[model samples]
Target: MPGVMDIKRKIKSVKNTQKITKAMKMVSAARMRKAEDAMKNARSYANKIYELVGNMADRVEADSHPFLTARKEVRNVCLAIITSDKGLCGAFNSNVVKKTLAFARENKGVNIKLICIGKKAYDFLGKKEFEVLSKYVSFGGKITYDEASEIGDKLVDYYMSEDVDEIYIIHNEFRSTAFQVAKVTKVLPLSIEKTEAAETTDYIYEPKAEVLLKEIMPRYINFTVYFSLLESIAGEHGSRMVAMDNAARNAGEVINKLTLTFNKARQGAITNEILDIVNGAEALNG
Candidate 1:
């Protein structure tokens, strides 16, 4: 049996740890709420833009824009992977990395290049054989449209220069505080599905539909990247909040068990002392 002093010290240490975890949980919860709000606000605009672009693509000929045309042969591929800069989110980064790795493995024959958006993804994918075209590390917590535009511009240059034939994005989609889904989506060569509304609706082009497409397609790409970044940020905060809450709860349980043991040890010591005193008194009387 351990001494009371040792157990007391352990309980004190665990209590300090519990305090830290509880503080972290509260902080993360606050951040998660802010992030989720940002994500929700941005989703409306992003979705509308996406729908407009898709519908426009359907009405226009594939040759009308470079973004609308699919390559006959896919020789090279680029993957833009979004991950968290810092960890502590339970399996949030790992899930994205796993999805990215699975995609890389599946496309074994093609030349694969990576555009890593976060520190964790860059660090993990950097060691791999695939060429890392661009890497953004420690990019802060918030994302801006300008940053997404810059990334989009580089990707457009690559596509126009024939550096890569196809581009895809891997990220986590925020569903709720407790749930996020890892998703892989192709961003380039806009998947133009012919819908009934798209086929029936026809509008006169003021400056030619081709010119309009050229102007809007780049924006589409940039917004897609921006939206994905927002989703990732929200997911990261949510995951961290959940993980920290669990950690605090586990610490509380551990502290309770340790306190019980300490009480038992102290009780046993007191009982032993009482027995010794009683036996001494009896012996003296005899």
Candidate 2:
């Protein structure tokens, strides 16, 4: 059993840790709210852009643009993986890394290259045998659309140059403050699925459908990347908030146990002193 001083030290340490965790939980909660709102606002625009592209593909020929055409054989694949720059979150980064590795393992024959977006992804994948084509880290919690556009442009260049046959992105999709799921989405060679509910009315193109496609398709790809980044950021905050909340609770439990132990130790010390005094007094009197 530890002495009263040792137990007091432990209690103080735990109380300090509890304070830090509580502060972190509050900060993460505030950030999560802002991130969720940003994510919600961007989601509608991203979906509309996707819908517009799908509808346009239906009206145009298959070979209207290079992005609209699918490759006959997939030879090489590129994965743009998004993870948090920092981690205090439970399994948020680990889950994404595991999913990406599983994806790589599942597609053994194809050549896989990585475009890592966060420090976590870059650090984990960098140590592996996988080829990392590009890495971006420490965006300082603020990712701009222009930065996303740069990444998207690089992917487009890779596709156009025949460097990669397919491009996919892996990220954490924000569902709620308490829930997030790892999602993998293909962004290249643009999959066009016809929607039954979409209107069949004919529409006129201003600069011709082909010309407009050349202009807008790249924008669509950029927006997709940007939206994914936003979603991942939101998910990161949510995960961290939950993690810190749990940590604070655990710290509180530890403090309670330590306080109880301290009281017991102090009581035992007092009882021992009293017994020693009584024994000495009885011996002197005898």
Best by TM-score: 2
Most accurate candidate by lDDT: 2
Which tens-of-lDDT digit does each residue in 46-113 have in candidate 2? Answer: 77887788889988888889998899999899999999999899899998999999999999999999
Candidate 1 lDDT, 1-286, residue by residue in tens: 9999999999999999989888987987888888888888988997799788877877888788888889999999999999999988898999999999898789888999999999999988899888999988786767888988898888888898989999999999898887988899898888878775545668787788889899998998988888899889989888988988898899999999999999999999999999999999999999
Q: Report the number of backbone clashes for model 1.
A: 0
Ten-residue stretch with the least lDDT total in model 2: 193-202
Candidate lDDT values, in order: 0.88, 0.91
For candidate 2, the TM-score is: 0.97
The whole-model C-alpha lDDT of candidate 1 against the native structure comes to: 0.88
Candidate 1 displacement at residue 221 in angstroms = 0.4
